[model samples]
Target: MGHAPVMTWTVRRAGPGDVGELARINCESWQHSARGVVPDVLLDRMLPESYLNGWRRWVRLPDPDGVFVAEDEAGRLGSYCTVAEARDDDDIHADLRTGELIGVHADPLHMGTGAGRAVHDAALDHLAEQGFRYAVLWVLKDDWTTRSFYAHHGWRHDGATKDHAAGDQRVPVVRYGRFLNARKRNRPPSGFRFPAFG
Candidate 1:
């Protein structure tokens, strides 16, 4: 029996042309990850079209931040992440040169394929390159899997919490942060290249 060929991923900066795919991935990932935590009504109402419009606007605007994506050898978008200057009023480290990891989602089917890691690593590297001294991200309080994932990647909860309204319920989220250069501040690994953005 012949073994299947392993798939590799390419990481790049997301552009306007990728809005549709990015929105699709975002919507689907939310559906998969928020099934029980988020209210059913809210999840059901989340259409790709709505997200597409938001992504379109973001891509059209001038953002000092960056959106990065990971694609498989077959040219399918497997995951995406976004990083930007911390703009949250609740951020405790607002005084520091901090960046916020706004979002990072992987296709449910691609969860274990390193797509998430590829985009996450690139996002951190990009933030460091942008001269951010620290980084922060929010995750569902009860989402153990994702929490552990971020923890393993060197993030730690800083005892911060926020409530996100979903229907009649206010879902709690925890904040995680780390030094942007906590890990090595070198170039990305071999075979992966950061995209050039204006």
Candidate 2:
């Protein structure tokens, strides 16, 4: 009359070992979902090995306070996120809102399993804990699925645009944002935490 236990996943700082899995998720998710949104050339360039190397370099970047990964019961990474306060410092996006949800990527197979949402929640929770009052990110105007994905999570339309690079192609992107309460932000996980804001 015994039952099997439930398998719980944990979200924590990403380590060097997660690079391979993270790259695979990044490559597969982008390649499969962003077909018409991103340029074909860019997809071609996101080669598996290239992505692995890229992640290796990324994990070494001077990000003493960014990047996180989610691991399931098997201790395998399922998704990851990169949160930054100074978006301008990075060339990935144009606007570079002071408080921004820099980047979030999830495994294609884990799309609807809440891994993406968990990654995003962790980022925002971290930022809000860091005292950020607002956050922004650019989404392709023509990428309805991606847009809906953001909207479904409560991002308000900002009615803005920015030049996005899809390989060599430049396209205008729509902006969306969310205003953190600044008074009651989500709490970060224990040990590693950011100062609370009001």
Candidate 3:
């Protein structure tokens, strides 16, 4: 087999103007990357135009939550990453120091070209900068390719599982976690809370 093509890209915080392209990329990546993992019924509903408004709203959200995109030298965006503080008050740790890797999706044409990695790394850096001590992500249990990708990057399955809603279906997903910045653990002062990202 031919070697996987090498790809070069730079990551940056997403802006209002990027919503359209980011929406397109999100829908396209889901259609391609989640093909066999997510139920066909759900994947079939992923349409670029339908995602534009959602992308617009998401990109406008404040810090602690972030959206980033990877662009090649030619100015074409190849992937995007979204992150925030972990939302689950049950199951996953939902504290000031815990964050979530909401998603990292790449254009099908850039799947093996390193675009995903660039944005993924940048998302983690953003979380660390926000003072997150740990990060978690959820992936379809059957998406071996994606699970392996996270594993290669030092994430470990954290023995948590949930039935995530995918359209009308509930599909099993596993959680993976990694330490963004390992340090002695200390409790936040009573009544202390990080500013809400929502």
Candidate 4:
């Protein structure tokens, strides 16, 4: 019996032409993942066109390093991630040179297909390449799946918390951070294994 061909993914910087699909992916991924976390009304009100316009404007700005997308050999976009300098309100414990993983999303159908990991690794590499010593990200406090994913990838929560206003509700979030160079040394605490790409 013949084995199925192994699927591979490639990560690349997003361009102007990708804004429409990126907006669709962002909207769909958010609706799937944040259905209960974010207000249903807000999620329902999200328009892909609005996100497309926003992405278009963002990509046109002076950011040479901004967003990235992961695609399979079949040219399907499976995941995307965005990185930026840490914001003052991010409550990060790292130095001012830290970078932030502002957003990451995987198409629900591609959740376990390694696309997410590829985007994440690419984002970290981009941050390190840009001379950021540390990286930080925020997750909903009750998002165990996301928290576990970050922890398994060598990130640690540093007791920082923030509440983001969503409509009339406040959603609590926690911060996770990791040293970019330390990851290169494969020194993740508790023997966490960084999976190698095929």
Best by lDDT: 3
* Pairs that collide, model 4: none
Whole-model lDDT, model 2 = 0.68
Q: Write the per-residue lDDT of candidate 2 for residues 48-141, one digit (tens) a residue.
A: 6667877787776653246788778788776788777655543222322246665677776666666767777877777767766567777778
Query: Model 2 clash pairs?
Result: none
Q: Residue-wise lDDT of candidate 4 within 1-198, one digit each (tens)?
A: 443333588999888988988898888887888888888898888778978778997666554257889998888888899888777644443233578888788887777678878888988888888887677788888777778878878888877788978667899989887878777553544554432211
Candidate 3 lDDT tens digits, 1-198: 565697889899999889888988888888887788788888888788888888888998898999999999998999999999888865345444788998889888888889888888899988889988778899989888889978877787877798989888888999887767532232234575522322
Worst 10 residues of 2 by lDDT: 89-98
Using Cα atoms with residue i matched to residue i, what is each candidate's TM-score against the true structure? 0.85, 0.76, 0.87, 0.84
Ranking according to lDDT, highest score first: 3, 1, 4, 2
Off by over 4 Å in 3: 91-96, 182-198
Candidate 3, residue 25: Cα displacement in angstroms equals: 1.5
Which residue pairs in model 1 clash with each other? none
Model 2 residue runs over 4 Å out of place are 1-8, 60-65, 89-97, 182-198
Best by TM-score: 3
CA lDDT, every model vs. true structure: 0.79, 0.68, 0.81, 0.77
